[model samples]
Target: MQAVTFQAPGEVRVEERPEPDLLARDDAIVNVDATGVCGSDLHIYHGRVAIEPGFTLGHEFVGTVVAAGDGVTQVTEGDRVLGCYCSACGNCFFCRRGDFHQCDDGRVFGHGKTLGSLQGAQAERVLVPHANLTLRRVPEEMSDDAALFAGDVMGTGWHAVDQAGVRAGEAVAVLGLGPVGLCAVQAAKAAGAATIVGIDSVEDRLEAAEAFGARPVHLMEDEPRAAVKDATDGRGVDAGIDAVGHPDALELACRLTRKAGTVAAIGVYAERVQIHMGVVWIKALTLKSGQANVIGHVDRVLAMMAGGLLDPTPLVTHHMRLADAPEAYAVYDRREALKIVMTP
Candidate 1:
């Protein structure tokens, strides 16, 4: 099977790789139908997130189950399915507490050895461990493009709004209009936010956010803090979602949120970054930060997608053959595409 492999910073190669097989009782083998090139994948591509060279590199995918072990009853062979990016041990401490994302024995697909050595779904086939919790049956009416988001990007957006407790008639601001940011805007709207602000420096992204029913705020030309204040009648927004994994964005989220409001940082943060502790302390803001628990939230995301309350199909700006993954990565790296779906 041909799979996308990371060779060095800013480089991905499509090369023949061995197909994956079930190695655990809870595992299933999936014949990938479509997969996505996500922002997190870009981190590994840039070597900002270290991974072994030649590691299979992709996570978001919708596929058909080719085979399943006896323990995998959530989905069956030949079932159309979409999988969460990470696999968790159902008996782990965090898993018992419903924090599957923090499972001590969790393994993230396509993230290299450090993340579990699990080969990615970018290939012709992928081994899905803990299939009972990691894979969900795709809805009959849901397009592959939409189903692709249920496991990752869309789930993250929903998590941001869920964690922030964005209530109906409340105002909220989302920082960084990337795929996740745009999805966060949609989630906020679905959650009944009366005023949703989408902040970004990219004109196209801002436009996209506007289409998702958010008022776009340019990060450079417009004062986000002022915009939030004005929109919220000088009290700042009820909640702020930082979809950009940067110190600046985080700081802005804190500043734009009303005192006693919640801020959900759904972006990927790596190293130690400076924060204005005084502001957080003074405002008594509720800060929630971490990766999304897609496994926990996938069902909710799927329901929203099925009900037409949330649609991410528009977010998919490009589609390419799996053979063209290298070109796809280059296009995504240049910021030419929002979501790139690849078929095997």
Candidate 2:
């Protein structure tokens, strides 16, 4: 077997690695058919997120079940599956409360030993813990490329909208047009948002957002605040989503949200950054930030995909073999692709 490994900052290598096997009764082994190079992978590539050198890297995956432990019954051998980026102990207090993302024993894949020594799916195979909770059977009609998002990116986008309490006829603004941001646009529309402002600097991304039924606003060329205000009749959006994990983007989300509105920071934030507390205080804004509970939402996300209410197939910009993962990472790092699906 071969897996993508992080040897150092700005360096990822594709190398032979041992195959994974079930390590627990709740575990399952998957023959990875397709995986994605996500923005979080870029964090490790840039050394912003520390991980052990040579650690397997990548989480987003869709595959076929090859083996399952005795306790794993939700999926069986030969079942097509997609897995959440992380796994939670079903018995945890948070898990019992439907807050699986905050489960006390949650472990993230491909994040080195600190996140659970679980090797990543950017390989010929991966070992999934708590298979019944982590893996979801892919619908027969869903493509590998599209089903891949049900476990991670699309789920995160759905979480963003869900956290913000987006309602029918409400105005929403999504900042950033990456895969997650773009999916947020689609989710907002599906949730019945009457006005969605998709903000990005790239023309192509903005165009894609428009195709998703959002009113695209260029970050620099067009005034996002002005456009949002006009769209909301002088008031800012009822919900603002910061899909870009940067201080500036977070601040902008604050500025674009109306008083007493909600700001959902769905982007990855791993470091300390400054934000205007006074602004939030004066406006009485509600702020929510954290990782997505993909395991909890995968069923609904897949249902939406299966029903044709949400389609992320358009976000797939490239498809490559797992052997070309190094090159794929480089392309993604350079922003040359939107969502690169790598097959093993």
lDDT of each: 0.94, 0.94
> What tens-digit string does per-residue lDDT give for candidate 1 at 44-78?
98888899999999999999999999999899999
Worst window of 10 by summed lDDT in candidate 2: 112-121
Write one digit per residue (lDDT tens) for candidate 2, span 1-344.
99999999999999989888778998999999999999999998999888999899999999999999999989999999998999999998999999999988888989998887878889999999999999999999899999999999999999999999999999999999999999999999999999999999999999999999999999999999999999999999999999998889999999999999999999988789999999999999999999998888899999999999999999999999999988999999999899999998
Candidate 1 residue runs with Cα over 4 Å from true position: none
Each prediction's TM-score against the native? 0.99, 0.99
lDDT of 2: 0.94
| Residue 109 lDDT (model 1) | 90
Compared with the true structure, the alpha-carbon lDDT of candidate 1 equals 0.94
